[model samples]
Target: MKPSIPYLLAYAFTLASRRADEELREHGLTVRQFGLLMQLRLEPELTMAELARQLGISRQSLHEMVGELEQAGHLRREPGATGRTLRLTLVPGTARLLFDAHGPLMRAEEDFLRGMGKREIETLRVLLQRVLAHATDDEAWLA
Candidate 1:
Protein backbone atom coordinates (compact mmCIF):
# COMPACT_ATOMS: atom_id res chain seq x y z
CA MET A 1 0.00 0.00 0.00
CA LYS A 2 1.12 3.50 -0.79
CA PRO A 3 1.80 5.84 2.13
CA SER A 4 -0.26 9.00 2.57
CA ILE A 5 1.40 12.39 2.27
CA PRO A 6 0.97 13.04 5.98
CA TYR A 7 2.58 9.72 6.80
CA LEU A 8 5.46 10.46 4.47
CA LEU A 9 5.92 13.90 5.98
CA ALA A 10 5.91 12.48 9.51
CA TYR A 11 8.44 9.84 8.56
CA ALA A 12 10.66 12.41 6.89
CA PHE A 13 10.43 14.73 9.88
CA THR A 14 11.41 11.93 12.25
CA LEU A 15 14.37 10.93 10.10
CA ALA A 16 15.59 14.50 9.75
CA SER A 17 15.16 15.18 13.45
CA ARG A 18 17.01 12.01 14.40
CA ARG A 19 19.90 12.91 12.12
CA ALA A 20 20.03 16.44 13.49
CA ASP A 21 19.96 15.17 17.08
CA GLU A 22 22.87 12.85 16.42
CA GLU A 23 24.90 15.59 14.75
CA LEU A 24 24.16 18.08 17.50
CA ARG A 25 24.80 15.61 20.32
CA GLU A 26 28.54 16.28 20.33
CA HIS A 27 27.81 19.97 20.96
CA GLY A 28 25.46 19.05 23.82
CA LEU A 29 22.41 20.41 22.08
CA THR A 30 19.09 18.75 21.42
CA VAL A 31 17.41 19.28 18.05
CA ARG A 32 14.83 21.64 19.56
CA GLN A 33 17.51 23.66 21.38
CA PHE A 34 19.58 23.91 18.23
CA GLY A 35 16.52 25.16 16.37
CA LEU A 36 15.87 27.77 19.04
CA LEU A 37 19.47 28.95 18.90
CA MET A 38 19.36 29.19 15.13
CA GLN A 39 16.20 31.26 15.31
CA LEU A 40 17.78 33.61 17.81
CA ARG A 41 20.91 33.89 15.71
CA LEU A 42 18.85 34.74 12.64
CA GLU A 43 16.66 37.26 14.40
CA PRO A 44 18.53 38.97 17.19
CA GLU A 45 16.65 41.01 19.72
CA LEU A 46 13.38 39.52 18.64
CA THR A 47 10.48 39.93 21.02
CA MET A 48 9.26 36.84 22.83
CA ALA A 49 6.00 36.88 20.87
CA GLU A 50 7.82 37.15 17.58
CA LEU A 51 10.22 34.41 18.53
CA ALA A 52 7.38 32.17 19.67
CA ARG A 53 5.57 32.82 16.41
CA GLN A 54 8.66 31.96 14.44
CA LEU A 55 9.21 28.76 16.38
CA GLY A 56 5.56 27.60 16.23
CA ILE A 57 5.73 27.17 19.98
CA SER A 58 3.95 28.69 22.96
CA ARG A 59 5.25 31.89 24.50
CA GLN A 60 5.36 30.19 27.90
CA SER A 61 7.40 27.33 26.50
CA LEU A 62 9.68 29.83 24.82
CA HIS A 63 10.09 31.63 28.12
CA GLU A 64 11.22 28.43 29.72
CA MET A 65 13.59 27.69 26.88
CA VAL A 66 15.02 31.17 27.15
CA GLY A 67 15.63 30.68 30.85
CA GLU A 68 17.50 27.45 30.20
CA LEU A 69 19.60 29.02 27.46
CA GLU A 70 20.29 32.00 29.63
CA GLN A 71 21.59 29.75 32.38
CA ALA A 72 23.79 27.99 29.84
CA GLY A 73 25.16 31.34 28.64
CA HIS A 74 23.70 30.81 25.18
CA LEU A 75 21.33 33.77 25.20
CA ARG A 76 19.64 36.42 27.30
CA ARG A 77 16.39 38.35 27.38
CA GLU A 78 15.93 42.01 28.11
CA PRO A 79 13.26 44.63 27.92
CA GLY A 80 12.21 45.37 24.38
CA ALA A 81 12.27 48.80 22.79
CA THR A 82 8.52 49.04 23.16
CA GLY A 83 8.74 48.17 26.86
CA ARG A 84 5.73 45.91 26.53
CA THR A 85 7.73 42.88 25.44
CA LEU A 86 10.94 41.02 26.18
CA ARG A 87 13.59 40.55 23.52
CA LEU A 88 16.09 37.77 23.08
CA THR A 89 19.74 38.17 22.18
CA LEU A 90 22.19 35.43 21.33
CA VAL A 91 25.49 35.63 23.15
CA PRO A 92 28.64 35.98 21.03
CA GLY A 93 30.25 32.82 22.41
CA THR A 94 27.09 30.84 21.84
CA ALA A 95 26.80 32.35 18.39
CA ARG A 96 30.25 30.94 17.68
CA LEU A 97 29.12 27.52 18.81
CA LEU A 98 26.10 27.70 16.53
CA PHE A 99 28.27 28.85 13.65
CA ASP A 100 30.76 26.03 14.17
CA ALA A 101 28.02 23.41 14.42
CA HIS A 102 26.19 24.68 11.34
CA GLY A 103 28.54 23.02 8.89
CA PRO A 104 28.20 19.60 10.46
CA LEU A 105 24.43 19.94 10.62
CA MET A 106 24.24 20.85 6.96
CA ARG A 107 26.47 17.90 6.15
CA ALA A 108 24.20 15.64 8.16
CA GLU A 109 21.19 16.86 6.20
CA GLU A 110 23.04 16.39 2.95
CA ASP A 111 23.93 12.86 3.94
CA PHE A 112 20.29 12.18 4.63
CA LEU A 113 19.34 13.57 1.24
CA ARG A 114 22.16 11.65 -0.41
CA GLY A 115 20.81 10.37 -3.66
CA MET A 116 19.01 13.61 -4.49
CA GLY A 117 20.49 15.90 -7.11
CA LYS A 118 20.34 19.70 -6.93
CA ARG A 119 17.15 19.89 -8.94
CA GLU A 120 15.53 17.22 -6.84
CA ILE A 121 16.53 19.00 -3.68
CA GLU A 122 15.05 22.22 -4.97
CA THR A 123 11.86 20.43 -5.92
CA LEU A 124 11.61 18.92 -2.47
CA ARG A 125 12.16 22.32 -0.92
CA VAL A 126 9.39 23.83 -2.95
CA LEU A 127 7.02 21.03 -2.05
CA LEU A 128 7.82 21.35 1.61
CA GLN A 129 7.28 25.09 1.44
CA ARG A 130 3.87 24.46 -0.01
CA VAL A 131 3.05 22.14 2.84
CA LEU A 132 4.32 24.63 5.40
CA ALA A 133 2.19 27.36 3.86
CA HIS A 134 -0.90 25.37 4.71
CA ALA A 135 0.19 24.71 8.28
CA THR A 136 -2.25 25.85 11.03
CA ASP A 137 0.36 28.37 12.11
CA ASP A 138 1.37 29.70 8.72
CA GLU A 139 4.34 31.66 10.03
CA ALA A 140 6.24 28.59 11.10
CA TRP A 141 7.96 28.54 7.72
CA LEU A 142 9.93 31.60 8.75
CA ALA A 143 11.86 29.53 11.26
Candidate 2:
Protein backbone atom coordinates (compact mmCIF):
# COMPACT_ATOMS: atom_id res chain seq x y z
CA MET A 1 0.00 0.00 0.00
CA LYS A 2 1.11 3.58 -0.63
CA PRO A 3 1.23 6.43 1.91
CA SER A 4 -1.88 8.61 1.99
CA ILE A 5 -2.02 12.38 2.35
CA PRO A 6 -3.06 12.14 5.99
CA TYR A 7 -0.22 9.74 6.71
CA LEU A 8 2.29 12.02 5.03
CA LEU A 9 0.92 15.05 6.83
CA ALA A 10 1.15 13.31 10.17
CA TYR A 11 4.71 12.24 9.48
CA ALA A 12 5.65 15.79 8.50
CA PHE A 13 4.02 17.11 11.66
CA THR A 14 5.98 14.62 13.76
CA LEU A 15 9.24 15.76 12.19
CA ALA A 16 8.40 19.41 12.75
CA SER A 17 7.28 18.76 16.31
CA ARG A 18 10.45 16.87 17.13
CA ARG A 19 12.56 19.71 15.77
CA ALA A 20 10.55 22.24 17.75
CA ASP A 21 10.91 20.24 20.93
CA GLU A 22 14.66 19.97 20.56
CA GLU A 23 15.09 23.69 19.82
CA LEU A 24 12.69 24.81 22.53
CA ARG A 25 14.30 22.48 25.07
CA GLU A 26 17.48 24.56 24.80
CA HIS A 27 15.49 27.53 26.13
CA GLY A 28 13.81 25.46 28.89
CA LEU A 29 10.46 25.42 27.15
CA THR A 30 8.12 22.66 26.04
CA VAL A 31 6.03 23.01 22.91
CA ARG A 32 2.84 23.26 24.99
CA GLN A 33 4.30 26.05 27.12
CA PHE A 34 5.45 27.87 24.00
CA GLY A 35 1.98 27.51 22.49
CA LEU A 36 0.38 28.91 25.63
CA LEU A 37 2.73 31.86 25.60
CA MET A 38 2.03 32.48 21.93
CA GLN A 39 -1.72 32.41 22.48
CA LEU A 40 -1.46 34.85 25.34
CA ARG A 41 0.89 37.02 23.33
CA LEU A 42 -1.54 37.15 20.42
CA GLU A 43 -4.63 37.75 22.55
CA PRO A 44 -3.49 39.29 25.78
CA GLU A 45 -6.92 39.53 27.31
CA LEU A 46 -8.04 35.91 27.03
CA THR A 47 -9.60 34.55 30.18
CA MET A 48 -8.56 31.16 31.49
CA ALA A 49 -11.57 29.41 30.01
CA GLU A 50 -11.18 31.16 26.69
CA LEU A 51 -7.52 30.33 26.61
CA ALA A 52 -8.20 26.71 27.44
CA ARG A 53 -10.67 26.54 24.58
CA GLN A 54 -8.26 28.12 22.17
CA LEU A 55 -5.44 25.83 23.23
CA GLY A 56 -7.70 22.79 23.06
CA ILE A 57 -6.84 21.89 26.61
CA SER A 58 -8.82 21.45 29.77
CA ARG A 59 -9.24 24.37 32.18
CA GLN A 60 -7.53 22.48 34.97
CA SER A 61 -4.60 21.73 32.68
CA LEU A 62 -4.45 25.34 31.56
CA HIS A 63 -4.53 26.44 35.18
CA GLU A 64 -1.58 24.23 35.98
CA MET A 65 0.40 25.60 33.04
CA VAL A 66 -0.61 29.12 33.99
CA GLY A 67 0.74 28.59 37.48
CA GLU A 68 4.04 27.39 36.11
CA LEU A 69 4.32 30.30 33.68
CA GLU A 70 3.43 32.79 36.40
CA GLN A 71 6.10 31.37 38.66
CA ALA A 72 8.60 31.63 35.83
CA GLY A 73 7.78 35.33 35.31
CA HIS A 74 6.62 34.62 31.77
CA LEU A 75 2.98 35.44 32.32
CA ARG A 76 0.53 37.10 34.68
CA ARG A 77 -3.16 37.18 35.32
CA GLU A 78 -5.13 40.34 35.87
CA PRO A 79 -8.75 41.03 36.67
CA GLY A 80 -10.73 41.18 33.50
CA ALA A 81 -13.20 43.89 32.52
CA THR A 82 -16.07 41.86 33.90
CA GLY A 83 -14.22 41.77 37.24
CA ARG A 84 -15.09 38.10 37.60
CA THR A 85 -12.74 36.88 34.91
CA LEU A 86 -8.99 36.55 35.05
CA ARG A 87 -7.16 37.57 31.90
CA LEU A 88 -3.84 36.04 30.93
CA THR A 89 -1.12 38.37 29.67
CA LEU A 90 2.52 37.92 28.88
CA VAL A 91 4.96 39.47 31.32
CA PRO A 92 6.91 42.63 30.54
CA GLY A 93 10.08 40.88 29.37
CA THR A 94 8.31 37.98 27.65
CA ALA A 95 8.74 39.61 24.25
CA ARG A 96 12.49 38.97 24.43
CA LEU A 97 11.88 35.33 25.25
CA LEU A 98 9.36 34.96 22.44
CA PHE A 99 11.67 36.70 19.99
CA ASP A 100 14.55 34.48 21.00
CA ALA A 101 12.46 31.33 20.73
CA HIS A 102 11.06 32.37 17.35
CA GLY A 103 14.44 32.46 15.63
CA PRO A 104 15.37 28.81 16.07
CA LEU A 105 11.95 27.54 15.00
CA MET A 106 12.05 29.68 11.86
CA ARG A 107 15.55 28.53 11.09
CA ALA A 108 14.48 24.93 11.54
CA GLU A 109 11.60 25.47 9.15
CA GLU A 110 13.90 27.07 6.59
CA ASP A 111 16.28 24.15 6.90
CA PHE A 112 13.42 21.69 6.48
CA LEU A 113 12.17 23.50 3.38
CA ARG A 114 15.67 24.14 2.01
CA GLY A 115 14.99 23.54 -1.65
CA MET A 116 11.54 25.15 -1.72
CA GLY A 117 11.38 28.52 -3.51
CA LYS A 118 9.51 31.49 -1.99
CA ARG A 119 6.57 31.05 -4.32
CA GLU A 120 6.38 27.35 -3.59
CA ILE A 121 6.40 28.03 0.12
CA GLU A 122 3.64 30.60 -0.27
CA THR A 123 1.58 28.16 -2.30
CA LEU A 124 2.09 25.45 0.29
CA ARG A 125 0.93 27.84 2.99
CA VAL A 126 -2.16 28.75 1.01
CA LEU A 127 -3.03 25.11 0.43
CA LEU A 128 -2.60 24.30 4.11
CA GLN A 129 -4.77 27.25 5.05
CA ARG A 130 -7.46 26.03 2.69
CA VAL A 131 -7.31 22.58 4.25
CA LEU A 132 -7.51 24.04 7.74
CA ALA A 133 -10.41 26.27 6.72
CA HIS A 134 -12.30 23.26 5.51
CA ALA A 135 -11.47 21.10 8.51
CA THR A 136 -12.30 23.41 11.38
CA ASP A 137 -15.57 24.99 12.35
CA ASP A 138 -13.98 27.94 14.09
CA GLU A 139 -11.67 30.16 12.03
CA ALA A 140 -10.94 32.54 14.91
CA TRP A 141 -7.92 30.46 15.91
CA LEU A 142 -6.63 30.58 12.35
CA ALA A 143 -6.27 34.33 12.75
Off by over 4 Å in 1: 133-143
Q: Given candidate 1, what's the lDDT at residue 26?
A: 86
User: Candidate 1, clashing residue pairs?
Assistant: none
Clashes of each: 0, 0
What are the runs in model 2 whose C-alpha is more than 4 Å off?
Answer: 1-7, 133-143
State the lDDT of candidate 1 residue by residue for 11-94, as single tens digits.
988999899889988887767788899877766866787778777789889888888888888887777888887778887799
Candidate 2 lDDT, tens digit per residue, 51-134? 787676899999999999899899888888989888887878888898899888777678778899999998887777677666
Candidate 1 lDDT at 70 equals 88
- Model 2 — which ten-residue stretch has the worst lDDT? 134-143
TM-score of each: 0.79, 0.76
Report the error of model 1 at residue 92, Å: 1.5
Q: What overall lDDT goes with each candidate model?
A: 0.81, 0.82
